[model samples]
Target: MHMEILPFTIAVPDAIIDDLHTRLTNTRWPEAELVDDWSQGAPLAYVQEVCEYWANGYDWRTRETALNRFDQFTTEIDGLDLHFIHQRSPHANATPLLLSHGWPGSIVEFHKVIEPLTDPTRFGGDAADAFHVVAPSLPGYGFSAKPTETGWGIDRIAGAFATLMSRLGYDKYVAQGGDWGAGITTALGALDPTHCQAIHVTLAMGARPKLDKELTPEMHHALERLQFYRDWDSGYSKQQATRPQTVGYGLVDSPSAQAAWIIEKFWAWTDNDGHPEDVLDRDEMLDNIMLYWINGNGASSARLYWESFGKGTRHVVTIPSGFAVFPKEISPPIREWVADSYTDIVRWQRYDKGGHFAAFEVPEVFVAEIRSMFRRYRPGF
Candidate 1:
């Protein structure tokens, strides 16, 4: 089969923007949450305010222009049309790097670090540290083609990404991701070790360690946090995994539903005192929400969980791997625990700040981590 890599641009018609305004203006809002905190969900007032700003103040053209500043392209891989942003470095010998985003995140998450990673000298770093960056929107997310069948899980997604890298003429590359991106990256390391030189992941999903002895304070805390997530924080995952179509209706039809559904995760997973905006910009968060809204991927994106959540893709990764431990990550597995699954762990660093969305929350730190990890595995560091 022949695959064509076509240059792509983002140009939403005026009719779509006008329709969005009508929907936001005429939204039928619900009553405020009973509690003052966000324990229940996104506060009614908060959602209303954000939606109002989205309708009137947010400018998709500005976001579209900034996105188009980078070279974007689409290619068919494994019967799915994949969308990716490819930025080549000025340095001829720059290493190729494939960056992947997870659920509720789009290529928008990597916008902050793309230039710095691709042109390190401009960012006050050595030119040798530069990388030819390729960040792809996952299947059923953003501009990537939505899967119509039932087999588009993480394993298949990993295979598609490897095909994408090959299609782009990269024989070897490093992969980095967090959230669902982390899972797919790990899968890539396992499935395509010959081409995937190394991997850096913010979220390390390994087997649950079985300790014969007592647990340490840190281990206990990690377990408690994981349990809390399964109990309190995993409601959306369960809903999405079991009945995506049922929930996707609300998300696709009602922009407010989509915004609240995604914004709630940002608030829950980010390292923020009270609100998601404390660490993330309001417009940036809205831009991510708009990716889902405009693409009408509310249901398709959620179906990823349904496809592969418990299909047992969490196998051990043997390639040289680096794990960045963020302080406020939704699931912060201990280094000792992760070492069991990632046998060839080369680097492990714990940060005092940041959370699930490290690239978005701390681009400087994220870039530093990526460079430091690959430097260990890259030839002649």
Candidate 2:
């Protein structure tokens, strides 16, 4: 029972918040290169407006208080400190589900789903489907102290999560994820075929078609789009996986740069249509950015690629899996391609909406999908 939580009463210092604003106010912006479209990535007008709001109006303490409203705690697992928010349902038999997030995301991703999933009565859903939610900031992200050791790859993180479940005394549980969260959930499916039971993923990079095999029409289209994207859309990942330190310099230095980098993804991937304001409220989005900034995990968050992909790669797969393919992620995988890797088919849904940050962009959609997937395993009469 090794549990410790930072006293929720703790408040962020005014100076730190002021410093963030000061840096944002003085951002040394590059000369705007006019592009015919947003093809250059992160439009100057949009970034300037966002950075201005972040500097003048964004509130960190309010966001921190909102985050601290949950019962956040830490426990030692496998020689590392794991930070997670543990919200138990009054339903004694409520199923346990672990949700993980990816880079540029934190526990903030699930903030919208918490109330609906915890107290269904408040949200017009059935109490029978309530979950004892365990959302963890991946090692080296958010409240979890950056790992001092290496080898904490996705598989290792999956194993650590299994320990977290067992430590919480959950004998059987379902897993859910988006982005790197999806990858970790897949890793969990692979590592705990006996106990993890099932998985739900948003960023199922494993959706790749079988190698050395001809691509189907859908998959061929997906492959072509992916190739085109790699040509233009993968600089961040390549840099993160190869030289995180250099990339870290920009994010670690300026709050505006960090906001621009992260919010651009929201604009690019969401239904924003060149205006993130259309899809996300500025403060709600900045709360997420604050989680990274206040925790000083921006660099370490980027280093996940360095730590995992840097050593090598894992193309291996195992166990039953489900995919919640959103419109804005990488190319959706046809089931035929999925079957080549994960032999067990549980469920797959191609959503009409949602992008990379599935939980935040569309909580109701994700919650409904989770309930649908878990019913296959939690068939309690």
Candidate 3:
């Protein structure tokens, strides 16, 4: 299929911003959570505080300009206009690298790491470690056109990305992701081993606990976290997977509702002591939230859960793969759990810090991990 890749720019009109302000000012807030902590949900006071700043102090223009610094474009792939940041390295032979983001995250999550990955010499890194980064906003998220039809699940999304890489003239590339991105990247590695050489993911989506295995302390802790997710942390997923449209009404209509829904996850998932702000500043978090708000992606993005949950396509990845085990991940997988699925595991590193939003929370460490893993596979290495 002939595809036309067009240059894209993000420009939210004044009217939309004004509408957002009006909504923020008029939000019908519920009473504060009865509990002192976020066990119930995003606190009323915190949501109000974030919404107030989002209206008054936050500058979308500045953030938009900063985002546009990276080369961006849109292309018709699988009947959708996919938006992506394609930052090429100054080095002549830098490897093409595809970065994927998951739910509650936009391309905003990679803003900090893009520069270092694309131009490593400038950031006090070896020229050999540079990458030509291609980070796409998934269908139904950010500026990318949402799917009006069903069946835009993980397998199809991975195929679309492979088409995207080919459209960009990249015959060989490496992939990295966490969360849904991890699942898609894994699929990419399995689907197109000819072009997609290797994959590095913080989350191994194909992994499952071995019920009969003797449990180590780490395994015990991981199972406990998994149970915790099933009991507490996964309510958002359940709701989105079942009734995305029902929730999208509130998310699209009220900026406060949208911010609270996403912000609470940041606090819960990141390696922060008390609040998400301990790791990521309000502006950084707000910038991510704005991508969802400006695009009115609440329902559209959430529908990805509905379309892919329970029913997913995860082919065993035979390509060389690497895994970064972040300590505070929702439930870090053991190599053995995924060994049957992700064969040829090349690099596995467990970090002392970082969490689900690895690139956003620890860009330096994330960059280092990518470099360390892919150095061997670089062309002519």
User: Candidate 2's residue-wise lDDT over 1-381, tens digit each?
Assistant: 454444233266888788888888888888775885667777777788878888777767677778777777778887788889888876656778899998878888899987677666678878778888999889988778787877777878888899988888888888988778877888888778777878877665655556577766667756765776688777888988888778788888877777878886777667556677777788888887887777677678888898776353443456567877776676665777677666777788887787777788888988888878776666242
Candidate maximizing TM-score: 3
lDDT of 1: 0.89
TM-score of 3: 0.98
Please provide TM-scores, in order, for all candidate models, with all chains considered together: 0.97, 0.92, 0.98
Q: Tens digits of per-residue lDDT for model 3 on 316-343?
A: 9999999998878999878888998998
Q: Which stretches of model 1 miss by more than 4 angstroms?
A: 379-381
User: Candidate 2: where is the Cα deviation over 4 Å?
Assistant: 1-10, 210-217, 310-318, 379-381
Per-residue lDDT over 180-269 for candidate 1, one digit per residue giving the tens place of the 0 to 100 score: 999999999999999999998988655575576788876776677787888889999999999999999999999999999999999999
**Candidate 2 TM-score, C-alpha based:** 0.92
Please report how far candidate 2 places residue 39 from its true position, in Å.
1.9
What lDDT does the true structure give each of the candidates?
0.89, 0.77, 0.92
The Cα error of candidate 2 at residue 28, in Å, is: 1.5
Clashing pairs counted in every model: 0, 0, 0
Question: Which pairs clash in model 2?
Answer: none
